[model samples]
Target: MRIKILSIAFAALIVAAAFTFIRKEVKVDVKSSQIAWVGEKVTGQHNGTVNIKSGALDVENGTIKGGEFTIDMTSIDVLDLEGDSKGKLMGHLKSDDFFSVEKYPTALFKINSVSESKQADATHFISGELTIKGITNKITFPATVTVNGDKVNAKATFALDRTKWNVRYGSGSFFDGLGDKMIYDDFKLSVNLSSL
Candidate 1:
């Protein structure tokens, strides 16, 4: 009876230890910038940083199980605003027309699957549920991961259509009225993440 009890206790300890090793905190960095034409002969680049909260990376056996990620939308800032007036662009972007910062303040990318990419450099492909403006979509992004000790590096580029998440204002046929020829629906995203 004592031996049986000891066996169970030992097994439980092993399981607990394995679980602990599976998940760890992570940090992700975002340096994506964009150039938008404000008017004739005028353009500016929008820049921002993504700060994550309570991020965790998990591994089961030899495969990555999942990771939880969030982006800090409050950090968004546009550079080179035409003249000293920058409030207009910032206010409009944070309004319900674009990201609706008041209602949906942050964007999230919760992991659903991880796979090995067929790229020559042994890249990793991650599929996750991306939530923006209260809409979630399962999207895939190609990440080139490099393991250095306890750290993991992931870099990739992706695009998002604002209209998909109900951000349909200031777009479409009104293109002719707008300063630019036509506001492009496709917005680019670039990520450079280093996690432990």
Candidate 2:
């Protein structure tokens, strides 16, 4: 009986040590991360960028177990326009008709799960809850993630329906007779992240 008890305790210690070795928490390098946005209308398309405020990732056995990131919505910048034309668009985007950056200056995404991707080019499928303008919604996208030593790099591109998050504005679904003034409901976001 004594020998059996000792063996059981040894097994428990081994399991605990293995678990500690497999799981890790890493801080995100917000300065090195980038999130680009693209919005289209019947007339043309506009592209810009937003900053990542902070983030962290849970890595387990070289795979991302979970992660969360905060976006600085007030950092939205238009790259295609210059002078007042750019200023006007930026003002409108921050107003209540769009992201309402004054009321909600930051957006957040928290990962709920991650799974190996079946896509040839993608590494994993990440499911998470995205909160914008005080509204939270579930979003899933494929990402290419790599881990080397203490560093991690990830990239993902996905489109989100603005209407689902109550970003109505000139959306054709909410307003008729918009014609060319109507902005498409879906907007694309491309994210690149690196670990500190």
Candidate 3:
């Protein structure tokens, strides 16, 4: 009777261990990660970087489950210009004509879902809500996500229409006859994020 009881207890312990999940929440390396952006008009374009304020990622059994990030809108940089020109553009971006960063100094992104991709180049597809200047929109994009014990690296290139978020300055969609001075509605972002 004792031997039978011991065998049953050992079997139950094995079953419980098998059902245990391996999951972790990792904070992103804000200084090492970057978000690059590009805005274009008919004649040319401006490119810059925005700083990430804070972020964290959830991993389930070595797969990216979800994450959320906050961006410092006041940290916008116009990389191509120099001196006063850079300052002017940066100021304009922060003003009401553009992002109104003084009023809304932060933008946020919350991941809703992540799925493994069938393609070789991209590791996963992501769907999330991106909030800019206090407006939130659902955006979906593909990313290359890699996981190595305790570390995660993710990269993606995606486009967002500024007008969708009520940023209508120089946009032809709202005003006509702008000709060459019209700015395109779509702005691009290249994101690279690292978390541990």
lDDT of 1 by residue, 1-196 (tens): 9999999999999999878744444444333312122211114335433445435556555456688777666655665565445678777777887788888878887998889999875488889998988899888878777655556666777676666777666566333465643455656666666654
- The full ranking of all candidates by TM-score, starting with the best, is 3, 2, 1
lDDT digits (tens) for residues 1-196 of candidate 3: 9999999999999999998878889899999999999999999999999999999998888888888999999999999999999999999999999999989999999999999889877888999999998999999998999899889999999899999899999999999999999999999999999984
TM-score of each candidate structure, all chains considered together:
0.70, 0.92, 0.95
**Over 4 Å off in model 2, which ranges?**
1-21
Give me the candidate number with maximum TM-score.
3
Q: Candidate 1 at 58: error in angstroms?
A: 1.6
Spell out the clash pairs found in candidate 3: none
CA RMSD of each candidate after superposition? 5.6, 2.2, 1.2
Of 2 and 3, the candidate ahead on TM-score is 3
Between candidates 1 and 3, the one scoring higher on lDDT is 3
lDDT of each: 0.65, 0.94, 0.94
RMSD of 1: 5.6
Where is the poorest 10-residue window by lDDT in model 3?
115-124
